[model samples]
Target: MSSEIEELRKEIENIDKQLIELLSKRLKIAAKIGEIKSKVGRDITDEKREQKVREYWYTYARNTGIPDSLVDNILPILFSYSKMVQINPGKKKNITIIGYGGMARSLASLFSLVGHNVVITGRNKEKAERLASEFRFVYMDLDSALNWGEYIILALSPSSMDYIIKISPKFSNKVVMDIFSSKNEVFSQLEKLSEIYSFNYISTHPLFGPLLYPVGERIVLIPSKSTKNLEEIITFWRECGLNTTVSSVEEHEKAMAIVQVLAHFYILGLDRSVEILKKEFKIENLSDFFTTNFREINKIIEKVNNILPVILEIQKSNPYAYKVREIGVNELQKIRKELGE
Candidate 1:
């Protein structure tokens, strides 16, 4: 309507076009760097380099009067895309994922994106087929997939031990890995089965949630008694753009007890408390008064609720769960006394 407004809009459009062109040029250079790294056998993610780049972005943002919030939000996404372009997998292997759940889809997406041959299989053939078709992968029967795959990922939950037990005999000589959250009891069970049936069992825990193309995510790898070719397995995950950390069963369980069990326990309590307070105070439209920190906490609450079963399972299975929760409650009581509440 106004000439000044129209002129400003045109200028913004031109700037947008220039930004897109600059991004394309940057990605092209990143691809060339990826080529060099691959030739030299270097990992895709260079953490020190990433930190320097992040500092540079922040310094530039400060000099340009850009908000720290903008830098915080945009840098991770830019870094993720940069890593996605730099992924150059080596000697693709046949990966069979044995579930049609969120974690299954996430791994399938990452493996397929990195040029691996993937097959989806489970008892529910229809769900398996649908997930496979999403990534142009084939869906095979349980026995057929187990026979065909060189690496089998048991993406099912820890409660699915019966199903895992039934199929334990077929895993002979195959490199089998289970992505269970808590490994206290499950690890021992699987390790014993691996020894009995003569399979290489490697326990794994993905540190991130079910997200497609989860570049730069971290995965914890715990080796069982029968684990072999450990270096090769590490390389496989590295090539798929995941940061891998090796830990023992005890260390892994302790870490999860603090990280997952304690955190979820507090969040679940907060969620229930929030609901009780809301109903007691006759508070409606409480979101309108939410602060930025509360908004973030609410997001975590929503995510925890979405996967309540998994969260509860971790709480139940983690050996340190009782200790962690007791400490958490004691800390809250101390805070309450300090506040004179």
Candidate 2:
């Protein structure tokens, strides 16, 4: 029995080597495509082509007796790698990221992947150094980072924004951006500071979490009066495998009122209600009996709980937050009345 097991393991290892070789060939082909795309000034991601490929994979999977779910799981990873290989930045940037948090790590990972020099800096030098070491980035004091960097990303929490104002002098003539979701007062303050300090200010909200590489996430850019190289910045982000949307500060705030404010408001309320119901019903665990919808909701609830601080900050700062929450309450009340609950 041991001899048979060893023989089967050897066969598996041989297949794994063949798979690696095939993947290498695939990536080489993708690199060539990237070269051609660069010459033609085409974007790295071709969604239509990707969709066609997915459809082909689906049909091929069905015909070959392979599980459709396996194809679903593998295609996104393949697409991410394909985009990674295809993206050719016009110039390597000297990027300084403030805050050694998940978002900082995510951005640093992308920068390292795309051959950019990255510096991570914050109040906690040790934490910054730890995060920088992960991606071969430099860890430095804020003054040094600001001096060395061409582009600066403020990945700090909203509460830590005072650092920007305090160190305003270091930002002279540099391109700067903040990744705060709720723009309201913070945007105005940053814009004013940029003017006072003579720096390029572009407010940005990364419409995704701190996932590594984040190869096809959307980032909304709200250009202030001081923003001059908007097109150049957009091209830079596109080459980094991010889709960019230009929006006014007002429009961005209004949209987030609906997206973050309304959604998080209800999710928070729902989470509490779930906890209360569980206690009232004396139910200790619902995982064993969860339906697909319930499981998906549970995942969302978990994510919300983890990011509650940022959610609460958005809830407080968004101008239209109260109106949206009022609408949510009214809708829920109406449904309860109709159901006579």
Candidate 3:
């Protein structure tokens, strides 16, 4: 047993050294790409190139007898390497976000860690000033916002973005994105921005919950073809531990209607079912016996509970949302009939 342990430790140390050397070379290559991008005014991420790399990795993993799931987990690390290389290769970029929530804090830290300046803006001058003071970054008023930073994020609540973007025209040449859970409303406002502006407006949904990020995560991007500069920003997040993928605004809305909207409804139903079961007949020490992941299920329950009401509100407001909800109900009935119960 001692001999086996020693051999494994030696193997791991050898692998780590080789990994460091390869990573150093990879970062050098990414820095070269970033330099070329800066010169040509092109974005850092080549989506076509990323796709090619993904296929290559998956094929290599298969040939090596590695499990598909293990390969999938490694993908985020690869993207992280690409991002870390682009931003720091040993330098950083300046970034500003128009909110003070989790996404704001995360982006601020991400940009800074990569060696860039980060600023946070808020709804009021006082609040914005206060946040800036806390972060030791600059604050901006409505009239005299700084035109600094190549990237700006609108990390506002779902209800308030239209008004926010309406008056912030200084984002003219810069790339702007929103971390809004839904894309329709924000895009409607971003659409009003002039075509003459050198802007790329994309909708981003960071899939991980606010509590944990970059561990096991993916970020869905809904970008207008008009907003081509999103490539670098996407790659940046990919390195910061997000698996960035593109979806059309239409596709995002359709996918979320089911994944976000109806899935929330189903989880709510499950919670209610569990409640009724507990009230009627208690299980025998089942709660204590549940696996560790069962505790994590509580987190999912919290997520669904929080989002259920909002999705329901959207369903009430939109005709398409109503149709989608109706389909969900029909599907539930069919499921019930198909089951023996």
Best by TM-score: 1
- Lowest-lDDT window of 10 residues in candidate 3? 208-217
Worst 10 residues of 2 by lDDT: 37-46
The number of the candidate with the highest lDDT is 1
- Looking at model 2, residue 173 earns an lDDT score of 96
What's each prediction's TM-score? 0.93, 0.89, 0.64
Instruction: Report model 1's TM-score to 2 decimal places.
Output: 0.93
Better by lDDT, candidate 3 or 1: 1
lDDT of 1 at 110: 96
lDDT of 3 at 29: 89
| Tens digits of lDDT, candidate 2, 1-341 | 99999999999999999999999999989988987876665667778999999999999999999998899899999988987888777789999999888888888887887888899999999999999999988898988999999999999878887777898778999999999988888898998999999999999998887778987678899999999999889888877877778899889999999989999888888899989998999898868889978898989999988988888999998899999899989999999999999
- Those runs of model 2 whose alpha carbons end farther than 4 Å from true positions after fitting are 1-21, 36-49, 337-341
Q: After superposition, how far is residue 174 of candidate 3 from its true place, in Å?
A: 2.4
Residue 246 error, candidate 2, Å: 1.3
Which residue pairs collide, candidate 2? none
**lDDT score for residue 103 of model 3:** 61
User: In model 1, how large is the Cα lDDT of residue 22?
Assistant: 94
Clashing residue pair totals per candidate (backbone < 3 A): 0, 0, 2
